[model samples]
Target: MIGFSDTSISKIAKRASVSAATIYIYHENNEDLLYKTYLKIKGKMSEKMFQGVDHTRTVYERFEAIIRNYVDFIQSFKDYFLFLEQIMNSPLPQKWC
Candidate 1:
C-alpha cells in the first residue's frame, strides 16, 4: 500500500497504524525511504529482465531482449518514470544536474 505522494510517509504510517516516528526509526528520512523504494523497484526490473536471457543467443537477439525488457519496465512503472523526469528537469542538487 505504498503511495507516491508528497505525504507518502504520513500516508504509510496512517495505513500501517503507526506513528511517522516509527517509520523514522527504520528509515533515516523520507529521502532514504524513497531511495530504498527506488532500489527495490530497480532490483525487480533487473531480475525480470535477466529471468531467461540466454547466453548462447545471438548478440543482436540478446541486445533486443534487453532493450525490450527495459522499455517494458519503464512503461510499467510510469509513475516512477515521471518522478525521475521531474527530478531531472528540476534545478535541485547540482551533482544530479
Candidate 2:
C-alpha cells in the first residue's frame, strides 16, 4: 500500500502480521517497497483496463473503450490510482526506482 512516505516498514510488518525481517526480505527500503507495490498496482490496472477490449473496433469505438475502461479501473482501485498520481506529481519518488 502506498501510504505516507514516513511510514515505517516495521509498522507495516506489524500491521501485516509479519516479521520486520520478512519485509526486508522483499524490500530493501520504503522506496523499494513503494516501487514494487506501484508496479504491481500498475500491472493490475492495465490488465483490468484492457480486458475484453476489441482491437478490431473503429478508432472512435476504441477510444471510447479506453476511456470507459480507464474510468472503471480508477473507480475500482481509487487508492492505487491516487497513489500513482501522487508519485508522478511529486519529487519524493526517485526515478531510479
Clashes of 1: 0
Error of 1 at 89 (Å): 5.2
lDDT of 2 by residue, 1-97 (tens): 5446668898889999999999999899987897888788889888877887899999888878878989998998898899888777766566754
Residue 87: error of model 2 in Å?
A: 1.7
Candidate with the greatest TM-score versus the true structure: 2
Candidate that would win on lDDT: 2
- Kindly report which residue stretches of model 1 are placed more than 4 angstroms away from their true locations once superposed: 1-5, 15-17, 80-97
Output the TM-score of candidate 2. 0.85
**Candidate 1: lDDT over CA atoms?**
0.70
Cα lDDT of candidate 2 equals 0.83
CA RMSD of all predictions: 4.2, 2.3
| lDDT, residue 53, model 2 | 84
lDDT per residue (tens digit) for residues 19-74 in model 1 = 99999998987667766665666677787677677889999999888888777878
| Candidate lDDT (C-alpha), each | 0.70, 0.83
